[model samples]
Target: MKFIGYQSLITIVCYLFFIFMSFWCIQDLHLERHLKMHEMQGKLLIVILSIVSGYLLSSFVLSLMDSLRDLIYIFKS
Candidate 1:
């Protein structure tokens, strides 16, 4: 595969891993009690929150790594 393909593959894996971790961790929060809506709505809210949090976290980590690599290249050259 090309470099772009490898980057895409890594991104997909990172997103999936972070999303699963966020979902698992969020379950312990019991956010359902805070919601006044139906059970379905509460579950939907949890899912949305997990996705948002995971995406943000994953993006930050990826960007930070990329930035560090670039910085290293600058010093090396």
Candidate 2:
């Protein structure tokens, strides 16, 4: 079995954290009185945007790190 790198592990943790935050926001809405429809929709929108942006940023950073690692290996050889 091959070892999974730290970048992958950290990305997964961040994605999970985003999911947890979304749920927490929803729970907060439920706990509050006089819920407004627009307010809920706005919160959902924020969650969706955060997830998409986080995914894009994570992949970009991880790929850049991998390229740098490969370059280091090439120089060392």
Candidate 3:
């Protein structure tokens, strides 16, 4: 089996964390019986946006690291 690099591992972990957070937020919203409609909607939107933003940030970081690794490999070779 091939070893996964630290950047890839961190990216996967961040993605999973964001997914879990988004689902937990949705479950909380569903279970809250007293929240007004507008408030619930706002919270849902925030959670969704946060998950997307987090994923994007993680992806960007991963890509940057990959690029750096490639550059170093090229220079070494």
The candidate maximizing lDDT is 1
What does candidate 1's lDDT look like per residue over 1-77, in tens digits? 59889889889988888888899999787787776677788788889988999999899888987898789877787
Write model 2 residue lDDT over 1-77, tens digit each, in one string. 23567656776886676556555555454432444456667666656655776666666766776798789887787
TM-score top scorer:
1
lDDT of 2: 0.63
What are the runs in model 3 whose C-alpha is more than 4 Å off?
5-8, 16-37
Give the 10-residue window scoring lowest on summed lDDT in candidate 1.
29-38
TM-score of each: 0.89, 0.59, 0.60
Order by TM-score, highest first: 1, 3, 2
Residue ranges of candidate 2 with Cα displaced over 4 Å: 5-8, 14-37
For model 3, what is the error of residue 65's alpha carbon versus the real structure, in angstroms, after optimal superposition? 0.6
lDDT (C-alpha) at residue 21 in model 3: 65
Sorting all predicted structures by lDDT, with the top scorer first, yields: 1, 3, 2
Q: How many clashes show up in model 2?
A: 0
Clashing pairs in 2: none
